[model samples]
Target: MTAVALVLLAADFVTKQIALTHFSGSDPTEALGGLLRFTLVFNSGGAFSIGEGEAWFFTTVKIVVVVAMLVVSPRIRTPVWAVSFGLVIAGAAGNLVDRLFRAPSPLQGRVVDWIQLPHWPVFNLADCGVVCGSALVMWASMRGIRLNGTRESDAPAEAGATERTAEGRDR
Candidate 1:
């Protein structure tokens, strides 16, 4: 899972580089049949350019988020959790590349978003990784699955406590 995550991250970085150099044009170029486009737009804010021009702040926030995820990710053990963390790692690393490189230097770098849906905001591979990974984690959690890698059942303690209480009542 770590290997897969790193590979995905590397792929995201490489693809972004290509976009920066090749597709990072002054205009948005159609990559697929309108479903995809190689648009060269720089975002200095949050997802979908919510806070454009705030490069420094956003970069700092991103770094913090990535670092936090990296630190907490290793504790995740289940296969699904591992995959989810990997995807998140890929996304973080991908965007981190942009924050580290690109024009204007340092934390002032802009994110490269290209893939665009007809009705959705333009996004990139990294963004996809983030969204999918986050969703996986959320779904797993809702189903009572642990994201911390622990294999213990979620209801074990509750059930045990209930049994103990019933025994006390009987006594």
Candidate 2:
């Protein structure tokens, strides 16, 4: 989990720096025959530009998420769960860094977003991690894979079942 988080965080930081240097104040650069574009944008809001001018609120939320994930990480024995947690941690931390250090003052700084696709808002690698990680979290929950690496079916029998079995044995 640590490895995955570190790698993703580094990747996000490096890519954002590159984008800032190359794409800032420039028109969107086309790629993949116009299927993708690098369009630099500094966002002071949440996803899709929602809650504009609420950078402080967003920063607080991201900090809470990162801390909560870390607190629960030790119990995530399942590899998939670990990876999902790592991705979320990295994503939240990635954007939190921008909020803490970028510009316009701490906790009110804008996040650097560059990648763009047709009919989609300009986003960054951190956004991808958050979206993908959240999907995995949902999948694992629906499949009954617990954080401690146990499936629901593998757990001990319910208390009622155990009581019924004991009653029969005493007959």
Candidate 3:
């Protein structure tokens, strides 16, 4: 989980740096023939560009999320949970760094977003990590997979059955 998070964080950082350097002050760069484009943008907001100019609030939320993940790390027994948490933590931390150290001011810095998809908001790798991680978590929950590696069995056991009744004879 740590390794995966680190790799994802690095990818987010590097890609943001590339976008900042290459796409700023230029027209959007199309790739995959308009299926994807790189459009440099600075967002002081939350997901899908909402909460614009709420950098401080978003930063605080990111901090809370990272801290919460750290506090719950010891309880992450299953690999799926670990991956989900790792991705979320990494993505939060990735944006948190921008909020802390990027331009404008501390806690007021804008996040660098560049990737654009058809009929979708412009986003970055961190967004991808967060979205994918959230999807995995939702999927696990729907599949009855618990964080402690237990699954809720579909087969129902006979409730209120006495030992004699369970022995194939009526009590």
Candidate 4:
């Protein structure tokens, strides 16, 4: 989990720096026959630029998410769960760094976003991590996989049988 988080965090940081250096103050750059574009954007809000000017709120949320993930990481016994948590942690921390240290002042700074697709908002690698990680977490939960790597279907049959027997007697 630590490895995954660190790698993603580093990648996000490096890419954002590169984007800032190359894309800032320039017109959007197109590639892949206009399928993708590098358009520099500094967002002070949440996803899709919602709640603009709420950088402080987003920063607080990211801090809480990072700390919560770290506290709960030890109980994740499955690789999938570990990766899911790691992605989320790295994503939150990546954006948190910008909010806390970037231009405009601490806790009110804008996040650098440069990647854009047709009809889509300009976003960064950290946004990708957050979206993908959240999807994975939902998938795991729907599949009944627990934090300790146990599935709902893995529960002992004896417990179900005992419950049935008790219900029969009560009737």
For all predicted structures, in order, the TM-scores are 0.82, 0.92, 0.88, 0.92
Q: Rate the local accuracy (lDDT) of all candidates.
A: 0.78, 0.93, 0.88, 0.93
Distance (Å) between predicted and true CA of 14, model 3? 0.6
Ranking by TM-score: 2, 4, 3, 1
Better of 2 and 3 by TM-score: 2
1 against 4, candidate with superior TM-score: 4
Pull out the clashing pairs in model 3. none
Candidate 3 lDDT: 0.88
Highest lDDT: which candidate? 2
- For candidate 4, the per-residue lDDT at 109 reads 92
lDDT tens string, model 4, 1-171? 898889999999999999988885369889999999999999999999999999999999999999999999989999889999989999999999999999899999999999999999999989988998899899999999999999989977775798899999999
Model 1 bad stretches (over 4 Å): 24-27, 148-154, 159-171
Summarize candidate 3's per-residue lDDT along 95-139 as a digit string, tens digits.
899999998999999999999989998898998888888898899
TM-score computed on alpha carbons, candidate 2? 0.92
Worst 10 residues of 2 by lDDT: 20-29
Candidates 3 and 4 compared: the better one by TM-score is: 4
Pairs clashing within candidate 4: none
Ranking by lDDT: 2, 4, 3, 1
Q: What is candidate 3's CA lDDT for residue 145?
A: 81
Give per-residue CA lDDT, model 2, range 1-171, as digits (tens). 999899999999999999988895478899999999999999999999999899999999999999999998988888899899989999999999999999999999999999999999999999988998999999999999999989998989887998899899999
Whose lDDT is higher: candidate 3's or candidate 4's? 4
Q: How badly does each model clash, as a count of residue pairs?
A: 1, 0, 0, 0
